[model samples]
Target chain A: MATGAEQAHGAAAPGMPQLDFTTFPNQIFWLVVTLVVIYLVLTRLAIPRIATVLAERRGTVANDLATAEELKLKAQEAEATYEKALADARAEAQKIVAEARAEINRDLDAANARAEAEIAARLAESETRIAAIRDTATENVRAVARETAVEVARAILPAAASDPAALVSAVDRRMEMEGGA
Target chain B: MAVEDGGGLSIKPMDQFIVKPLFRDIEPGSCMPPEIVEGCLKWYEPSNVTLWMGLGIVATLLLLVVGTRGRAIIPSRSQSMAELTYGFVHQMVEDVAGKDALKFFPYIMTLFMFILFANVLGLIPMSFTTTSHIAVTATMAIAVFVTVTAIGFVKNGAGFLKLFWVDAAPLALRPVLAVIELISYFVRPVSHSVRLAGAIMAGHAVMKVFAGFAAIALVAPLALGGMVAIYGLELLVAFIQAYVFTILTCVYLRDALHPSH
Candidate 1:
């Protein structure tokens, strides 16, 4: 078997070194060209796309946070408005209740005043009727007493010597005695 | 046996090793001549695999840019994959270094992908292992160190220098701490580059040695069996090395962005 060193000397063909240069040169050149091309593709194309994607993702996250904040603010505003409305409703309800209570009280007071006036007028009318009745009774009693005195005088005197003055004096004395007894 | 067919002893292929040169045209000391180490800023030879790895880096950048040209709500597949990778790196940066340090994600991700692809490509048959070379790895490490240092200065100006002297030391121990910090800062690139290159080179060397053993001991089934086991282990080591390289880069970037930690 031929050793590598012996084969090197034995295979001293012409243009071998030059051919080595050309062959290796083409291979290395193409390899380098390919590498450069790949690098360019990566840097100019792939890397930028990747960066853009990342930037977009960041933007999305920020936008989402901003939207969340806005929504939270809106919710808070709604809560505040709801609370205000509730308070207004409560205040209005209280005002209505107060007015209703006052109106009822006023109506009750008017009714009470009318009842008192009616009672006072009835009492006055009853007092006036009682006085009239007393006056009539006194008059009837005086008329009856006078009539009885005249009847007694006529019974005691004779027909021929009938004098009105003498008979009245006698009857008055008798009536006085009877009244005293 | 003493009949003379030639003046000198006839040479065979096996005898060449024991004899002087049969071919006089070949220059002495010309075989396997040492190649000159290239300068860092030279226009990289397109034939060199390191240049190809660098091209791969550029390709990754281009793919990202073109994929993300028109952003949509629902992404195309290329766009989605790109986004996923970006998001993954972004999250990692944020998680490792905190949100304040996320600004360095682009640079870190670039470094990670470039190293990753270079490491992976080296695993292919006949492909050049760019990260395996000290010069290439060191260059990358130095670039990272410079960029991070620049970023720190840009962000904090003179205060950035305080990262080495002020933050880690008590007032009484400031001078001693400054010396130690300076040493460590200087050692950063060396450690970073060596770590990557060493792992890759060691792994490749082991794989080659085992493969050679397997070829030479073809008749010995036990040697073949051992080689099989070594090959499997090498595959795992390859992935692990790549991962370690990427993670270390991330850690270094984290340190740069947040020196307080």
Candidate 2:
């Protein structure tokens, strides 16, 4: 079978076709053409297009990163501003609270002073009234003592009734004696 | 052709590598006469190589060109795939060939895409593997070699020869080392081309041999299993070979750009 197949295709069939010098020109020619065409396509169209796309993608990514950074800075600034306002508001609130406390304390102090003064004045007025009432009672008691002395003298001696003044003088003298004792 | 005279299974493993014209008036199973085949397989004749190579080119265009049509920053699936491929090759070129060598990115990208697609496309059953042919691989390697060499001279002029002069070596041994370096440098294209073609050809040929064993009743299962395993391995080899070729190209470009030892 091998011999018959060889005889059918002649001398070229017995050996490796790769070594066949006749086909070299055809193979090399086509290979060169193919390479040339491929080179042209890559250089002219494919490489440039792909490169541009990649470059565009990179540019877009860079732009996005830059925008993100800018926004981040803006957000940070806003936060700082918010923090400062909060701090100022806190300080102002503390100040207002302190001022309210001082005003209330001052008002309390003034009211306490006024109440103490009124209490002192009321005590003095009560003392003076007590003194006056004591004085009036003493005067009444002396008058009653004089009347009693006069009655006693009248009861003792009816003839001595015209000497009432003398009995009063005597009661006075007794009162002076009791006061000295 | 599968049956020998004694009725035993006779497999021609090399038969698949036969170059034939795609458009022929002859019947499918019957082989064309040598004269007719020779007449048709001229330098301009489109063979399986042409078809497969053209398919590879189409696949490349579909991935790199049509896939990225939207040019979306947030890429679609196909567009992302295109970008991934682009970034992969771009990074490879930059890393291996250094930053300044990026000027040759398109060329390296072309080589990588073409070979990668060709190798992968060849994995399909009944498909022709253009990369398996030394003619194809050798042409690419020679082109890389010539271009790199020219760039080296153009960029560094006489200093390009300094690549062979190892300053670190002992003075007495420098001449010997230079000779060895020169010879190895010349051998670069040969090794680069043959490595890809040989690896791919060997894997395919071995797979064919194992497939030939599938005709036997007892070993058929083993043969099929082996073919599957080898197919998977070939898929890996296909990608790896393309990567090796491209990286080697980048390494060569690096040497040209900075030719110090």
Candidate 3:
């Protein structure tokens, strides 16, 4: 019967149907068929689909990584350019400050030199005028003294006959003595 | 085989492994004509083999085919399981065999899933373990063996014979070592098949014996506890056996692909 192998066969190891040789052919046949079918399913359909998903994921990841790298490089270049521009501006500002400071100092020095020369010239002129005035005043004083002395002599000495030449020589000799002292 | 002892309790421990026909009725001499018996022996006739094998296929398709039908980026539970299985086998095949051997990934994947599902399915109550039979395991093992041999010859031609030649041994011992190696090499498929079948058959038989002892009221508690423990162990064994079989296949494939002495 078809059921004979699936059914019980009397043996020493009574319940162990695995020892039965009768049912082997059927199990083996079906196992081959089942294994082949499963293999087909995996190769033709299931595994290929899985591989596709995996490969797609890998490709997307790699592409994303490449894009990220390019963007990073671009950011770095931008940062470098910004830093360069900043440095240039700072240098230019420093140069401008230095040049303006030098120009201001030159102008200030020129103004100070001009003012000192003018002040020196004014001081020399004032000294010259004062000397001239002193000279004039000294001359006037000497002349007045001489004239007063002569008039007084003429008015006081009416009895006595005065020697004019002797008087004049005496007055001259006195003036010379005072000037020498 | 039930035996009644002095206590009058009988147990048939080996009754579970029976391979009964699922459909045909051939009760001894009741079929007076020999033609019916001859008709029943035909290979194409469906039996318990068809039922269990069909169940394994159905389970595989449900998990793989239907579960992955959506192919969602965020997988459902069954889809996750399907992906996990795919990745696990894929990594194993790639790591154990070289990347070149991934060409045979489908075959290795099929074997792993089939054996794993078959072993797990056998754990159900009153279910027949297809892997427990030598016929089925032997067939798979022999197929692997033939495939590896054919690949070795096809890829390496006469150079494949160098795998048997032991240049590492001393000149005097080379022949002796070659003979020894050849025997063991030929014995690989036999051991591969028997290892799985024997382990599964032994576990089921031991559990059956324990379950049979559960009939005795005095020892029922102890027997049930033991059965539970053994059942747990069998679950672990089921997965380990499948892993062992698959890894060994990878090793053989590596040998065939690279067959250098």
Candidate 4:
């Protein structure tokens, strides 16, 4: 292609090299070569590397997300296990409490039974002792009454005085009749 | 090239757009032409366009090739940028043009890198705007047009022509819409190339105008401020234009792959 000045004196247009067809071949030729060079650079070198980086980034992202999801699931499983273990522990604690309460109630019942038996035995012994004392007092009052009756009789009428045995027999006979009635 | 209409104080905006041979006024003892200049392929003569274009390639390769040499799981800054560009273009092609069009993703990326770097590199002082020239951008646009058209024909057979036919419209309007659609379809390359070139050219021209105005001592500050503002706007335009060009290519590829209407 001829230079802008090299073109025949007045053949080329006065303005706009773009409109000047004489040099179009040269410009177009370089444009094509440049385009081809750039195209080759992009397709063969630049774009592929960029694509690889992009794909790697995507792969990294996907791998990270998958790992995160797996970790989340593991965390959830661990949480469930923790909850279940806590529930088991709680249930075991309740069972232990119920068993302890039952044991305490049994021990309390045994202690109460033992104490009641001892009190009942003590009351029976005391009742027996009281009966014995009453018997002794009844005998003493009879004896005293017999002795006084005899003395009074003797004082009142010496001639009409009776024996201690006869007086006691009479009192005993009257007490027996009243008791029967 | 631009001409000073009034005097030397005035600036010529079009001079930056001129193309020249890389070797100029070379004396025998001064310098020798590079191997590429004297290579067997006489067809491949390096010009200013080729020089800037080569720089654009080196820049692209620096970011994509050398920058990503580490390939660190955690990318370096340049590697990250390269990856971002790759993903952005990859996704655009896959999403807009469908999975089948992913095969052509490299081509889309090439166009994007070339245009994007060309525009951005052009912003530097004394750097040429390769994309601003229809010579460069038109070539890319025509290449996309041809590739997609071929894909359409090969994949969809003669049904590829259905892209121009409007079956949804009423029978009377269908033909009219088809005619309009056909004209628009054929002009894709022209508009595609013109849009990028025009945007870049206009921005540079406006900056030059401001730069020229700044030459006047009275309004130097205002002209400098305006140039700064426009330059900032142009920086944004540089990236946006590249994005627009690439995405439009994807859209056109989509139509070719699935030319239903």
Candidate 5:
């Protein structure tokens, strides 16, 4: 009886539809659709924004670098100009100092020459005046001596001295004596 | 084994391997039965759906690969279409995954394209929806989950596990939160696969039922008109389901890659 029941519940034929997992074609189809749509969306809309933002950032950085370089160059130029100006001022000051020193030396030399010439003239004049005074004194003494000798001769020989020749001889003799001494 | 006198049909397990029941027998020796091939473990037999999917893949590849070749400052029509797709995916990745996670743009874009193409093709009367299959969708979701998980680990090493338990839960609720986190993490693949498959299956079943009605009511003009409208509506549904599935996949990937957001 069990055998008969098993035989009655036999399976269906080999050509019947079954419920196996047979959906590869469907899955592949949807996969293709998803890929295509996504590819389109990505290419068109999303990538450009990112690229733009990156490019903008790069540009800003480059601009900043350029500005910094320019400022540096300007600063260098200013420093060079300042150094040149300082050098020029120093040179001008040296030139003025040199000119003033030369002027002072010239004035000192002139003053020394003028003082020497004045001292030499005063010494020569004193020497000439002293010589003149000495000559005058000698002449006055000789005259006085001559006059006194003549006067003595005349008193000693009052009666005999009436002759002019005698008086003259006596005066001559006194002068000769005085000169020899 | 002949037909019964009462006209009853009998099915056997071995009959499932045959192709005649699923499709018309064009000619003797022309129609082939499904066979298991060695070294290529296939889960399903090749059906009309497979052929449609192959065609869709070929079409998408042609459009994407041949459409844009050289970069142009100003794009041509084909190039513009390609650019539009790239731009859309890029924005979606940026919006969902954040700027730091844009490195995964290529993978996300490819995923979206594959799913979108499969979904849209199903809208065609004779086309197949590959995403409708659980194996395909589950495989895709698993891949995404694995990749995101791997990325988190690779990026943060052991710290990636902290994504689950690092929250400041109340002292009494810490254990509860941990359980919830574990469950949600496990459920990711399940929800991801089911969402796509269920949407496709429901839409296809509805279309199939309506088509059956159209076939049966061959003599009624009013019924034919209603069938045509339903067909149009199914077409719309097919596109919408594809978009929904693709968008949701992107959202899930974003969450996985960047759990903080």
Candidate 6:
């Protein structure tokens, strides 16, 4: 085969050296060696390492996704908590306002009741003083009418002046009739 | 061989495909003819194929091993690329070959990384494309063929032969279909290896031809532009061919695992 290849190469034009059969053994030998080296490197080292790296990457991605999901859930839970707190605060503030309003209304009602009672007492005292003054004025007017009548009778007749009792009785009878009218 | 005589341009595009030993003590511009296998290129000789393949292995290790050495859950840029490749091939194996084929993940991953690195690395200027050689690709393909076939037989025994026997066909045409299936089955490795080597070789050869035209002063700019355009295209082809090869491998593995359809 080597001689045949050499004879073929002896030709003027060697054509495609790839067709030269002599190099086949060398190429095949090295090819086998290269393939075996590649196979060993891959099976023993390269493939496993790359496979591990890939599996790790996939796992890392999945883990990241899971972490993101967890964080999202936690954020939703916090938002819900915040909403409940806000609602509670609002309700508490409303209750406090209502209580303060009720207290203010009670104080106002007490103040109003005290003022009304004091006004009623002052009115009753004023009425009693007016009644007493009216009583005194009525007495004074009766007294003046009696005295003026006596004086007029005496001036009209000297003998009549000695009979004051009869004059007094007539005056009393007239005053009584006026009072009734 | 690039030749210029009497202002006439001559470029041998295929000369670049020559598999010569790197340790040539010969004079510059003169290569030891491949016929002198005595000290020229022995079976164990360190040729350009060895160097590039070694580079491919180093690239494989750099991407897969050292890139992920951080083992960080949050990967670095190179580590991310490493992980992306891992997931890409892993999912491909699982999806195309089935979950039962997960045990073969390492093997599939090896092939994918090796070919992918080799293809991409070949794009470097002045670098030898190890995968462009039929001998190299054929070896890998044959290995896959043998391994998959062995696994099929070991797992399914005589039932593995059902792969070539299409039961869905009409009973009258079953034998004819079986013959076709059998031939196609045997041709899998040939097509597989050839497809990869051919794609790489053609792209590289075309680039070389375009580059050769650059020697002419008149169309130099056009040649350079074409080279740039083809370079961009070859970059795409580099990754796509790797993907195609790996996917086809998965398909073949699927057949081996099931061997019914």
What digit string (tens of lDDT, one per residue) describes model 5 on residues A1-181? 4433334543322121222333344344445454555556445544444355445656878998999999999999999999999999999999999999999989989999899999999989999999999879867876676666567767887675466565666666776687789
User: Which 10 consecutive residues of model 3 chain B have the lowest summed lDDT?
Assistant: B26-35
Interface RMSD (one decimal) of model 2: 3.8
Q: Mind sharing the TM-score for model 4?
A: 0.79
Where model 4 places Cα greater than 4 Å from the true spot, the runs are A1-25, A129-181, B1-9, B22-45, B215-221
Q: Residue by residue across B1-261, what tens digits does model 5's lDDT show?
A: 212223332222232122221243323232233553232223354455455556665655555555655344455687667666667777777886778777877767666666667677766765555666676678778877888788877776776666677467777886777688878887988888878877776666555544444434343465467668766776676656555655665676665566652
lDDT of 1 by residue, B1-261 (tens): 011123321112121111112222333223331353221112333435544465556556544655656576667786676677677677777777667777666556766666666666666655566666565566667777887788777777777777677655578898888888889887888998888877776665555544444434343476567657766675676556655655666666666666663
DockQ, Cα level, model 6 = 0.33
Candidate 5, superposed: residue stretches over 4 Å from native: A1-181, B1-50, B69-72, B166-168, B216-240
Alpha-carbon RMSD to native, per candidate: 15.3, 5.6, 7.3, 6.9, 20.0, 6.0
Clashes of each: 39, 0, 9, 0, 53, 0
- What's the lDDT for all of these models? 0.60, 0.87, 0.81, 0.83, 0.61, 0.85
Which of the numbered candidates is closest to the native, going by highest lDDT?
Answer: 2
- Candidate 3 scores a C-alpha RMSD against the true structure in Å of 7.3
Candidate 6 yields a Cα-based lDDT of: 0.85
Ranking by DockQ: 6, 2, 4, 3, 1, 5
Write one digit per residue (lDDT tens) for candidate 2, span B199-218: 98898888888888887778
Shift in Å, residue A150, candidate 6: 15
Query: Please, what are the lDDT tens digits per residue for candidate 2 over residues A18-111?
Result: 8776678878888888888888888888899889988999999999999999999999999999999999999999999999999999999999
RMSD of 4: 6.9
Error of 5 at B117 (Å): 1.3
- Per-residue lDDT of A6-117 in model 1, one digit per residue for the tens? 3544454322121222233333344445445555555655655677687897898899999999999999999999999999999999999999999999999999999999
Q: Best-fitting candidate, measured by TM-score?
A: 6
If scored against the real structure, what TM-score would every candidate get? 0.50, 0.79, 0.71, 0.79, 0.51, 0.81
| Candidate 3 ranges beyond 4 A from true positions | A1-15, A78-181, B1-9, B25-42, B73-77
Q: Model 5, residue B191: displacement in angstroms?
A: 1.1
Mind giving the per-residue lDDT tens digits that candidate 4 earns over B178-240?
Answer: 889988998999999999999999999888888888777788899999989999999999999
Better of 2 and 6 by lDDT: 2
CA displacement after TM-score superposition, residue B26 of candidate 5 (Å): 13
For candidate 3, write residues B1-261 as lDDT tens digits: 233355543455555665557887545323223444442324566777777877888888888878788776657788788888899989998998889999999999999989998899999988888898888899999999999999999999998887888888899998988899889889999999999999998899889888878877788899999999999999999999999999999999988988886
Q: Could you tell me how far off, in angstroms, the CA of residue B206 lies in candidate 5 after the best superposition?
A: 0.7
